[model samples]
Every structure is written in C-alpha cells, then in structure tokens.
Target chain A: MDPDRQSELNALRPDLLRFARLQLRDAGAAEDAVQETLLAALTGSHRFESRSSYKTWLISILRNKIVDTIRSQSRELSASSLADDDAGDDLLDDALFDRRGHWQASARPGRWGDPEASFEQQQFWNVFEACLDRLPAKTARVFMMREFLGLETEEICKETGISSSNCWVVLHRARLGLRTCLETNWFAGAGT
Target chain B: MLSCQRATELMSQEQDRPLSLAERFGLRLHVLICAGCNNYRRQMAVLRAACRRFGSLGGQ
Candidate 1:
C-alpha cells in the first residue's frame, strides 16, 4: 500500500475496532480479528482511491475474520457459550408474551414511520448501536451472522454449530429484543 | 389460527426461507386480523433493512 493509502486505512481502524468489539464482545478476539483484517488489507494487491469503498472492502474482510474467530474458539469454550445461549432464551418468553401467546400490553411493537429515513440522520445510528449493545452477546452473534454478513440459514448453522430450529429461535428473540429497544429509544420518540 | 407469538416466529423465519403452506396461510390470516402482529411484521422488515445499511455504514 502507498503511504497515502496506508494512512487512510489507519484512520479507519477505530471504526473497525469498535465494530469488531461490538460484534465479538471479547476484547482479545476482537483485537485479533481487527489485526488480521488490517494485515490482509495491507498485503492484498487491490488498489483503491475512495475511502468509502476501501472501508466497505475492509469491513467485508473483517466480517469473514470475525466469523472465523468466533468459529475457531476452543471446543470447550464454544460449548460453554452455546449452553449460555440456550439458557438465555427461557428468560425471554414470559417477559415478551402471556399464556395466550399475545404480546404483553406494553411490549407490542410500536408505530415507527419510515425506518429507512433514519439512515440519513447520523444520530439514529448511535441509537441503533446502543440497541444492538443491549442484546446478549451470543444472540447478537447469531443475528450478525444472518443479517450483517447476509448468510443463509444453512451457512449460519454450519458456522455457528447450531441446528436450524435453534438458529430461528435465536433470530426471533434477537429481533424482538432489538425492535423493542429501538422503539423505546429512537423510533417511538415524539419527533424522531 | 396462529397466535401473535407464532405469527412473529414465522415472520422472522421468512427472512431465511420460504414458509410452509400452513405457516404462510396461518400467519397471513393472523396478521391480517391482528394489529399487533402486523406491526411486528413491519418492524421485522425495518430491522432487516437497518442491518443491511448498518453493516455497510458502520465502518465509517
């Protein structure tokens, strides 16, 4: 990489680190993924001028590294976390719904006009980031594998070592959690 | 008839795969009649849209 390009990549490290840390939730693992991503960017022959495209490109690479880092955790560690993931779900049911399977009165989804428009407002992303932070780490990982990386169910199952049904459950739970959080903090505001 | 809970599960599952005939019919029937579930479906769509944009934009 040229000196100018190198500096540009350097400037993006903070954003990249923050993104990785949010997704991975383990400081050491996040650092490793970020480091490997930067190294890959440095060694690759791809040339770039636009910072936007380069950051996009770097994030794509970082996404893969994050998956790999999570996938590569020691067997015992992965098993323990997987158990944690399973145990977390039972706690969500009563809080979200009643015996009749209806949403609790206060927990129903709220009206949010034009969600896409929030993308144009920079502050919306901060609220979004906060909402994401409120999720359990493993649930967020499953959600990230499916949504952020755009992986299919089968691929996510393979990467996360979860069954298809379990994957669906985690995603459903994550959506409910994130949806409620965003509504409370951003969307349901008097004038968002 | 699917409950609001069940309908929302199918809605989320729709993100990954085509719902089964029974699931599709049931969820649609429930969502049409239930305002809470309809809102949930739309919110799920919004989350999907937001995540896609978020993944690309978070690098900045």
Candidate 2:
C-alpha cells in the first residue's frame, strides 16, 4: 500500500473497531472483523470508489462480514438437533405496553423535584445497554444507527436494506422494548 | 380515525416535539377519552424529565 493509504487505514482502525464492537458485541470478534476488513480494503484498493467516504465503505464491508458470520452460526445451530426456541412472544409482550390508547403524560420539569436526585438515582446507561442487548439483531442495529450513531432514518434504511415501514417498525419495537425493560427493572421500585 | 395503538404511537412521537395539526387532534382526542393512554402519556413525561435531568449530569 502507498504511504498515504497506509496512514489513512491506521487512522480509521480505532473507529472501525468501535463500530465492529457495537455490531458483533464481542471484543475479540470485533478485532478480528476489523483486521479482515482492513485486509480486504487493502487487496481491493483498485475498486475503491471515490463517491462515498472511505469510512462508510469500510464499515459497510465490516457489517456484511458480521452478518455473514451471524448467518453461518445460526445455520450451524439450526442444523443441530436442537430446536430454535421462540423468544418473539416475550419480546412482543414487552413491546405491547398498552393495549388501550391510554399512556401517561410526559412528566413536568418540577415533578421530579431535584434533578440531582434523579441523576443520583442510578447509572441508567447500564440499564439502557442491557435492554439494548436484548433487542433482536436488526431492531438493535436500526436503533443503534439512529439513536447512538445519529444516522438519518433514510440512511439507516438504506444501510440495513429495509423499507421505510420496516425501519419505523424496528425503531418502534426497539423503543418499546427499551421502555418496557426500564419500566420493569429500573423504575419498578420508584412506583412511577 | 386512528386506533388506540396508532394513537399511542403518535403520542410517543409527539413527546419528542410539537405535534402536527392532525397528530395534535388525534392525540388530544385519544387522551381525553382513554384513561390508560393518559396515564401512559404521564409516564412518558416522567421518563423524559428523568432523561433530561440525567443528561446534564456529565458536567456536574
């Protein structure tokens, strides 16, 4: 590789690893995926399209590789005698917070009284992360892309290869799942 | 007319910002009649306040 290309790849490595870790949810797998992605980018240097950012292109490759890895593992598991149990019903139950149209109104600013009181309540990010991990892969991916990465809805849809409705559905389900998880585990004691 | 589920979905969306005319009407009408939805809306508001309060903790 050229000196400039080598330097660029080095610069992008940390971000690649971060994105990979988010997708794969394992440090070792993320590192391996990043290594493979960099190697592939180096070999396919001739096909480098200048239309999009190099980071985007590289991340796309990493995402595809991760998906392939997931699918292969799933196939192997399915091929085994073990029947894949259904987790969908549980998720649906969580997401379906209210059958009736009724929902609690948004809390007023002073309702919580002291802001510091709420902050000191607990580390919410841990709860949030746990809830996120329980989401279906595609639902989690869409949620992360939109909420965490701040990607546009259209961009997320394109990246995930889903329709607009599907994107909305995934986001809706993800939000409901997170909300239910928080309400049950985090806020259960508060009586909110 | 929107179903209860659809109204609830729209209500959640409205929490993020000012609702459009249609959404406002839909949400207001639904909340007026649906006690469960009204409670849900209240809970969302509580959650949002909690989130905002927690959001500022980084500087403290």
Candidate 3:
C-alpha cells in the first residue's frame, strides 16, 4: 500500500467507526464493517476517480457494507422480538409530556443556537455520535435504518417486526431523544 | 384538536409516509398555534440535516 494512502485511510477510521456504529448499533459489528470498508477501499484505491471527496467515497463503501450486514441479520434471524420492550417509551412519554400530550414545561424544545455552526465543528460530531450511542439500542437501529439508510417506514416496520404505528412511535422517540441529547451536550451552555 | 404528542407523531410520520389531508391539517393547525410543538418540528429538521451531514462531506 502507498504510505500516504495508508495514513489517510487510518485517519478516516474514527469517522467510519462512528458511522458504522450508528448504523449497526453493535460495536463488534461496527468494527467489522469499518475494517472491511477500509480493506475494500485500499484494494480498490486505484479505481478512485476523484468524482467525490475521499471521505464521501469511503462512506459510500461503508454504506454498502452496512446494507450487507442488515441483509444478513434479517436473513439469519427473526425481527427483534424486542417489541415488548418498546413499551418502555410509556415511562419516557409520561414524564416528559403532560396528560394533555403537551410538553411538560420543563421539557419543551429550547432554541438550538447556530446549529449550522456546530455542523462545521469536528467536536460537534463527537458529541453527536456520543448522543447517538446513548439511545436505547433498538431505537437507535430503527432510527438509523430510517434516517441514515433512508429506508421507508414500511420497510423499517417490516424489518423490525413492529407495526407502522409502533415504528413511527419509535422514530418519534429517537428524534426527541437526539434533540434533547444535543441540547444538553452541545447547545445548552452555548446559548439560545 | 391535535395535542403536542399527536402533532409530533404526525410530524414523524410525515417523514416516512405521506400524511392524509386531515392529518396534515391537524398538524399544521396545532403547530401554528403551539410554540413548543413548532420548536419540536424545527428541531427534527435540524436533526435530519445533521444526520445527512454525517453521511456526506456535503457542506451545509
């Protein structure tokens, strides 16, 4: 391998790891995906056409690896029999929203100051990945399957064995949780 | 009347599936009147953009 290319590949590992972990929701599987992606990228380095930035190209490769993982997991086993576990959201919703289904005063979304600025900061991504890591595993997977992988709601519901309503509910929780997490970790002290 | 909770579910569903006319009306009406739900809707938009940023080196 060319030395410069090798070092560049090494530098991309953490970003790739974060992406894989969010997509796979399992550290071991994430590591495998990143490793495989790196290997494939190196082997196919000559094929690079400079059409996209290096990171984007690498992510495209990582995305395929992730899809393969999702496919294998689906074929090998049943959809998460963890549907019963989905009920835990009742506790979360009860505490955060009022009887009338309004935000508890304390739980309303505050202004997120300068989210565009945060997108430029590498540290913001670290916080983003950490918050994503904090979500309940299944919720994170379903959320990524929908948002990151761009899967349809019906496809996510079919894959997760949850009803369309349940799948929507899970996605709702994920968005709320991620927003809260970002607020606490990045936006709160930064300002409105 | 759409509660914040119901409006949010519709907001979420709107992302994946097309909302029925009634559902869109309820969500729009509630969000227009409710600041918190309005903020919640914006927050989800930011979150979606952030996720896309993570996937692409595409500058925002």
User: Compared with the true structure, what per-residue lDDT tens digits does model 3 show for residues A1-192?
Assistant: 878778888877877886787678779999999999998887884655453566677888888899788877854223355454456678868867999898898888777767888888877887888888888777788888887888888787676567887777778888877887887788876533
Error of 3 at A182 (Å): 2.2
- Model 1 per-residue lDDT tens digits across residues A112-160: 8887578778788888888888888778888887888788988877776
DockQ per model, Cα: 0.71, 0.16, 0.61
Alpha-carbon TM-score of each model against the true structure: 0.89, 0.53, 0.86
Residue B18 in candidate 1 has what lDDT? 91
**Candidate 1: lDDT of A27?**
85
Give the alpha carbon lDDT tens digit for every residue of A66-166 in model 2: 65554444333221211122257344543453454323233111122333444454455456446667876656665665654445666655555565555
Alpha-carbon local distance difference test for all models: 0.81, 0.57, 0.78
| Preferred candidate (DockQ higher): 2 or 3 | 3
The most accurate candidate by DockQ is: 1
Which parts of model 2 are misplaced by more than 4 Å?
A: A1-24, A29-116, A190-192, B1-3, B12-20, B32-60
